[model samples]
Target: MLRVCFTAEDLLRVRFADEPAPMVELMLAVATLQRSEAVFGLWRRRMGRALTRSAGPLLELVPATGKGPLFLDPPIPGFDAGLEHVLSTPTALVRSELHRVHARDRAPSPWTRLLADRDRDSWQNLEHALRTAHTHIVAAPWERIRAGFDAERAWRTHLLAGQGIHAMLTGLAPTARWRETTLEFDSTDDVEVSLDGTGITVLPSVYWTGRPLVGRYAQGWFLVYPAVTPLPDIDDPTSTDTLAMLLGRTRATILEQLLRPRTGSDLVRDLGLAKSSVSEHTKALRAARLITAQRDGKAIWHSCTPLGLELLACLPESRGKPA
Candidate 1:
């Protein structure tokens, strides 16, 4: 089990005192899970077969909100009525819009057939059915393993990891706002602590499992931070350095191809490299802050860092002049 420790000071920074620390943490966890599901669903629809490898890991890590009855008493602040209403209501509006857009088109994808059907109720039912059927058997085992290890310690580690992933995707700093109290884990491992914008000493622990699982679970939390700012312009010179660092590619051709967002598989196909190699290179790039990966269902989409574009523009053409 992963347990999170937050300092009093950290809690103050984020103004989280209004709600109890535990409650706030749970809410954040739920939100992050929700976002992951949404992103994953999108990817499953878009990429289809190519998503097999990453989809298993992602689905194993994050499961959907279950089929419990919608809460009517004091409802969840923004999402009071429930997910059905939340998804169904907007879907009706979107279906109409799509119909208009495709009115002149001769053909559309098989999946788009539903959009053309124009039955909001049927579509909504289908959506809910798909969500319900979507299962990640691995997630249950992993969660069981994590919980059995060190409940509170595991929770905190997963939380931080999720926040870190969120930071990369949205380009927002992953921060933990917590109270300053030092909570020791049951284990004897030295509780190494770190601080972020929040006034909390994030206690790192290794009580339950090894580092690999910790790293994998932590990613769920890392991708949870909100995207607070617009993505930086890719063409700016200063951004190129950042991109090169993130993607680990100095070649002009590779850099140029990454300008438009593409899936890891697409990149592998185009570059004639093995998928594993592409994944490794991308991970390194992500670690260096040179590129960002956005999860879409089962596949990860990659794009150049803003700094990468600047580097591309500065490179001299074959004719010996900058393009």
Candidate 2:
């Protein structure tokens, strides 16, 4: 298991990422594209077309199983900034990190060894691989990705407010546990990292769904894990017309209950709906930008957005009281 040792001061300094780390996310997205899940099916096609001209470099770094070179996932904002970070890394460091990746993975070609040497032509090709992948997988869909990040941040903030830092840390992942100062997540690697008051940057990711990446980073220590969004792939079926009927009332009631941030468990109990049904309704509302969800442990806390509040105000049935 991965263990994070936190000092009292370190606990006080737990930080949330204000923005998406594009490079880190790009690496993770490439990993997801390697799988054949329906959600990633479209991207897989695009990736094949986009990277056909030059493929092995990025793939070699981002293996199907374990993580890629740590240098690739720099905690920098914007894609260009991440590229800049990689560009600025000492050539020796790049070679060393890639060598470690080669030890664990089997994606390297004879040409990729130039990357270990930081050869000029090899560096350009690697950058080309990154650009192609980003264009195909991350560009057009960035808004959805950004929204997910915002929702996760809001969720983590809510948890911090109600339960404080310790609860927030241990509650980050379902299996994560806090024992005194060390936070543990189930893993086979048995890695331990100490945070000697440098604190951590808790980064939520849209594509990474594996063990939490607990590592010593430029930001002292870092934790990047999959966002706990409610069925991120499920879209709401209640169309605008359908929402005008009984379905509208259900959504209206959901909006009302959400005025004060509420957990999924609260909604299941209050709305008297099956978990699957509630997920359907909330997923729809979220897609409409009428409501937003933040993770509070495994249960996500849903709350109405400004647009939802305006809509709720106009609905005569919902105007009077909180549901």
Candidate 3:
């Protein structure tokens, strides 16, 4: 069991992450991918089919059962910036973390030894692997991930408003319990932490479908737990090819991009199309009531309607139900 003793100050400092940190989410996905739990089987198989061996070096560092080095996932804002931070970890910290990982695993692999010794070539290979993995695993599903975060925030916010913090914390799961100022939950490690006014960030995870993860990080402490709500359309093999065949590639691409609100310029730049092409596609989309547009001064923002989202969620051959 993991128990966290919190002070009043710590309670005051408790909060939610506004946006899912890319590095943090990526690391969680990597760890979750290693799991053999039945709940994760479908997700793992799909991701495994999609991902290449480009992520091997990272996998070498983060074992399935043991905690990875904290430096691999600092509470940074941007994904690339976070990767840069991981690569630039202090030599002493790298050695210490790798040694800790080794202690838990009880084996001496060649990569671990070279990494512990601060080998420059090994570092380069690691950097390449991490970047390649991020491109494949996180890039495509990012918008859906962001949507999941938004849903989590809304759900938690409602809970906080209606019940209060104690109810919010203890209500995380059936087994989670609160002892006055302390919160306790099941964990692999039997650990206790006193949050000495350094309050923790409470996050709802989409990838980490396991027991609650409570640990101190570079920024501070984080209590990341699994979210009950699954991401809409994340599981479905996006029938983009079908959508493309129906809508034509450009229109289909524009429709997918409109999952989030975007301006004409945003579409043009993002899709690498001309301004006229975006305007033409959006006009057809709006005419069909597949999307809605709002005027924000000079810019007209376009977003997918429920019809559009439903269309994406349930298309022919999509594995999802038919619309």
Candidate 4:
């Protein structure tokens, strides 16, 4: 079990990230290789083929079964930076971290030579592998996945306000709970972390599975746990037949368009449908509580609600159909 002790000051400093960081996603993608959950099976197969031998050094960064060193957790403050951010990790820190993790392992470390001298070529290969994996595995579904992350953040913020911090902490995962001044995590290992007053940043990750992961870095200590909800596979075809029978072609098309939030003009341009027709369809969807429309200044933005997303998940993507 892992227990984190927090002071009153730490509670005041606790916060959630507004968006998911790319570096966090990249590291979690590497960790996903060890998992066999159904949600990740498709991603795992694709990554298996994409990961090259050049990225061999990165595999040693995280252990296959136990807790990985804090070095794997780059202390990035925000989600703004891209792959370049990770590639810029200080050379000294990298070398020191590599030795720390490898020193404890019984097997020969493939990265010892490079870490010892901070070899330029070795770092170059690692960068290439991470960029390639990000492009092939994470880029396509990022928008939809990001939407899920944003929704979960919103829900947690509301929980903190309505029910208090204790509820919000326990709500993070099934194994997580709060007792007096300390937070407890159910895991195989026994560990204790005291956050004197540094507090902690909680990140909700779509790729992280199983128990929560904890690490400390230059910025501060933080925990990355699986989000409460998983993004639905927009391509799943389980109930497409039923959805088509209930909602007609045009309305079904409209719901599919809203898979990612779009403004009125966006739907008009993409669908090549008249403004009035799109308005009518949107009105019906809103009445059914399937989709929601929020006016921002002059333009109206539309997006699928939880119910709308569920219905769309049941239906297949719209193929070539007449406007």
Q: Is candidate 1 or candidate 3 better by lDDT?
A: 3
lDDT, candidate 4, equals 0.67
What are the lDDT figures for the candidates, one per model? 0.34, 0.71, 0.73, 0.67
**Candidate 2 residue lDDT tens string, 1-323:** 88998899998889999988888778887776676545456656766677766654677678754377888878878888788887777877777777877887765677768877778898888888878777765675676666667655765676687658986777567678888889999886778898888889999777666668875656567898876532234123232221232124466578778889998889889878888768877875775466889996787989988756755554444133323
> Best by TM-score, which number?
2
lDDT of 1 by residue, 1-323 (tens): 12234344544432111111121122222223343333234433443343344332222222232111111011121222233343444445445544543443223444445544655664554444333322221121223322222322322333345554223222212222223343222222233343333442121111111110101111111111211111111123223232222222322334566789989888778888777767755654453344678999999888888644543544333112112
Worst 10 residues of 3 by lDDT: 229-238
Better of 1 and 4 by lDDT: 4
Pitting candidate 1 against candidate 4, the one with the higher TM-score is 4
Q: Write the per-residue lDDT of candidate 4 for residues 139-251, one digit (tens) a residue.
A: 75676556656655765676687668887887676667778898998987798999899999988777665678777876688878776444333222233333432343466
Candidate 3 per-residue C-alpha lDDT over 1-323 given as tens digits, one digit per residue, 9 for 90 to 100: 88999999999998987777777777777887788855567878877766546676677777775268888877667788898899888989988888887788656579878877889998888888778778866777776676666655655665676668886787565468888898998777888999999998987766665677776777889887766433322322333344543344566678888889999999888778888767867875774456899999999999998767865665535222222
- TM-score-better candidate, 3 vs 4: 3
Q: How far is candidate 2 from the true structure (C-alpha RMSD, Å)?
A: 8.6
Which candidate number would show the highest lDDT if scored against the true structure? 3
Off by over 4 Å in 3: 49-52, 230-323
* Stretches > 4 Å off in candidate 4: 53-57, 65-69, 75-85, 103-108, 231-323
- Clash pairs detected, candidate 3: none
- Evaluated at residue 98, the lDDT of candidate 4 is 65
Q: So what's the TM-score on candidate 1?
A: 0.24
